[model samples]
Target: TGESDATVTNVIVASHYMNYGGYDNLKIASSTPYPAIGIKMGVCEGDSTLISILNKGMDAISQKEKSDIMNKWITVQYEHGVDMKKVSRIAIISASVVLFIFGSFYYWNRKLKKEVSRRKEAEDQLRNSFDEITEQKKIIEHKSEEVMDSIKYAKRLQEAILPPTSLIDEKIEKNFVLYLPKDIVAGDFYWMESTVCKESNNELNFIAAADCTGHGVPGAMVSVVCSNALNQAVLQHKLCEPGEILDKTTDLVVERFERSKEEVKDGMDIGMVSIEKISDTQSKIKFAGAHNNLWVISERDDIGATSNKYELESVSKSLFEIKANKQPVGKYEMRKPFVTTELLLEKGERLYLYSDGYADQFGGENGKKFKTKNFKNLILNSIDKDLNAQKEVLLTNFNDWKGSYEQLDDVCVIGIEI
Candidate 1:
């Protein structure tokens, strides 16, 4: 076979023939300068090459361009929804101003209301407190008046029960009585009566001072009962001796109350004396007491003066051992029977009788008591003074010692000079 250059040339001739026919026909039909196939074929192959080049040149682009693209995508949707810069700023400013005004007004209004409420509560509390205090004051005044009235009535009764001062004076040469009450009605009472003793062939004159169990109304009532019983014992019962008198009074008091009733322990502490004068220099004294004793003040001539000045009168200590009845004039379960004592008084001797009240009373700057020792000293110091002046001295001393404190007990003192 021959080298076939003829066959290759024939094939080329057929491709050129096809191209020319299509190209000429499209040119003629479209009336464009180039065939559509030419442009399409060139573009498809060139676009693929351009895409590969763009991917390779990515690192060469500026950062601004990359950032702009990213921001554009994020804000793209909100841009059309609102005009944020202009309209939003106006709305926010208006709302904040309205809220500030409302909050300030509300705070001031609440503060004013709280102040008004607090003032009203204070006024109400003050009014209620004043009312309570007024009511209590009225109650106290009423109670005080009642106590005073009771005391006044009891005092009158006590005065009527006591005998005249003349009766006591007739028995002793010179005498004095000092009586003080803790309240309006005293717990202590004094008595005087006349009697005759057949055994010693003597006409006896007697005086008595006594302290009842309690003070105030309770004590006053007991005093009334005791006073009545004592009179009856002397006059009606005819019990002359002090011991017999006390025994009779005790039986009467016990019998006055019922057996089934609640028992009351109310009785008296007493100092009783019978005085009779034989001459100007000689006299007789008989005494009895319940848990109490007496003292004697006498002038001694044995002591002399020094430096031409009269010596101070000596103060001697002597106890009047009155036979005390072991028993109280009441139905006490634990009481011993009373006993009587008799004594004869010489000239220039004095006898004293007193109750525990004055000694027990609280006084002094330190709130201490005007005790027995001080009382004795006072009596001795005032030996030259008259009975009335001596009494005044005692009262002054008591008041001075008492200072500003209230009297705690009733006070009583009796003195007799033979």
Candidate 2:
């Protein structure tokens, strides 16, 4: 709060944020409270290797080394949070067991082919082996149950972090949030909040669809950090500008991740928006994205984008595209400020913010991915439907396309009718 409120832009904040290659505005106020003193990396007590690594890292650092490392990066090893070696060992064991189990099926097939005269005895032996198979099945089922229970708990925690459904319903008159996770949990998340603009005394609705790096557990962790950053920018700093909010979020997220000892390239791609009613005929839409784009759909009865104002029908769908800055919300070798786009929408037009999961789904007869082109066509086919119905249509289409294949990633899409 103080950082945003400072009249003098030149100020001191802890230098941890600088490690992620952002927050250049704030300098360190003092040296005693290093980045480690304020931020923390949680680890399991049973993990001795990680604890030893931390001890060695701290002890190895000298004043000169601290200056060198502090000037460049903050350090905390992420392996303390999750042990990859144990997971890999478990995976290898599971694969070996599966192969052994399936090999029995092959063995039974060969015995049936080679020993028809002894079929009765072979059948007896196979039936007895089936008991063992059933035992393995029971064990697998028990383990699966435990895994699912933990995932369900994780799902609840993830849901609690999201904005309340009541708040969304109260603020947004016409909208639908389509969220689907490949697993019980997801990396894709949507953020929505409504605030009354003090200067204009108009209600402004803020919304974003973000796709965090990775999926499942890793992605979920990053989403929590990114989501908190968004909340801090909007709720704490009282920021409303789409570009400004994104910029602030970038700095915060970058700084947050920089506290790690490893080079954490993890980040999120977001399509953020601010919608305000300009008049009955028009509304102002401000959008900014980090490697994601906004789609504005226009109907003939409502408002349509004229070629004079916007490049009309650039997409095969019934919408015009507002391209995002071709950069992510984290450090890049080539840095560029996030670009913002503005549009005036008629009362009938609709806006869309989405993560890539929908388009990147692997499905269809050829077992191919449902690429962006097909996704656009599906949107165009369902153009006349209400936002809620559109969601159902999309899901149905996705299911039809997927057939027997599993979902590839977490999907999140948000639509609002202006």
Candidate 3:
């Protein structure tokens, strides 16, 4: 290593210099002939006082104290050999701990990813189901609209079949018809036909309030059949008597039903009247009913004096009821000839012909049927009013009694003032 140099010089340094490494190749030529220098203290150039004090303090220290201090600072303690086994064990344990932590993190991250994928799949399935439901709902709504359109067209046809108000007004001078159907089409109908009597040559107006078997479409169909039967009895057969007309009507209805293979038992409940004007203040009335009645209110005080031919139910001095046969106009085991009741009504008499819908309605304080007794009272109380005003009274009382309940059936009420 000294081949590059021409001359080699040796220098003596502090004893602490031997504590460091990289000096093994240097040789101590003569430790006893080494040059020596005295230890000196340093201070600022202008601070001679601090230098003097430090000199005094150093001089005051004993030689044994100085030697002990120097030995304490310079001494070094060193272990003889390294423990390779303990170092190797600590390194293995640390590596194992770090590996375990990273492995647990990786396992949990994979599990979380799988769970997220499963939730996304379920959400997609639910969205598809919702879309299918929405499409089905649209189809159902379209079908419902078609059905409602058909029903509305049927309603118009039904209305066209009913007798107009002007026709009724022309037939009866002072009359009011309160016709209310539970649905758009009704089972209840009011019919009137004017015909000339063959014997007396006087005009006879046949008026009726009839309730068919059911309500809505089925009832409306049956009503058409029954109404046609009445028309045949009056116009085709030339029947003027109420009882004879009903008899012919029942026969025609039964015959029509017999034509059907299935045993058809549908029929109507009717209150029919044939009115003929006799003089300026007198009129002749023939009444016949099938499960319906006629109410006559008069202030004349001789309610049953003129009509002794048939039994009369005298509810009050002014109100009188002519009861119908208990059986319906349709096929029945105990069917008999419908009785005709004849009455001569004078001026200021009120006549009422109605279906059972008014009295059969369900509502009130206890949600009970508006019984016949209450119906009689209502008509009797409103007898003083004109036919139109009395119609309003009847409608008001009916709605009040019905309250929030649904209407039970079709209502047809005809009030006539003579």
Where does candidate 1 stray beyond 4 Å? Answer: 1-143, 164-167, 170-173, 198-202, 257-260, 299-313, 316-327
Model 2, 7-36: lDDT tens digits are: 221112233454455755644432343343
- TM-score on alpha carbons, each prediction: 0.67, 0.62, 0.71
Better of 2 and 3 by TM-score: 3
Model 3, span 1-418: residue lDDT tens: 6343222232323234434543433333333445555445578998989988988998899999887876664433323244679888988998898888888888888888988998899989889989999999999999989877877887787777678889989988999999999997888998889999788899999899999999998898888888899999999999998999898999998998999999999999999999998988988988999989888877665665333222225433367778887877777778999989898998778788999999999999999999888887788766667888999999999999999999999999999887
How many pairs collide in each candidate, listed in order?
4, 3, 0
Give the per-residue lDDT digits (tens) of candidate 1, residues 1-418.
Answer: 7332222122223344435444222111112244333101123545877766665665566788766744543222111335667677877887788777787778877887888888888888888888988998899889888877777987887778877677667665588888888887877888777777767667777777888889877887888888888889888876678767777777777777546378776788887777766777866666667766655554443211111112233644333333355656677778666666665567767777888887877877678887877776678778778787888888888878877889887777888878
The lDDT values for all models are 0.69, 0.79, 0.82
Cα error, residue 236 of model 2, in Å, equals 1.3
| TM-score top scorer | 3
Which residues of candidate 3, in runs, are more than 4 Å off?
1-125, 301-317
- What order do candidates take by lDDT, descending? 3, 2, 1
lDDT of 1 at 397: 83
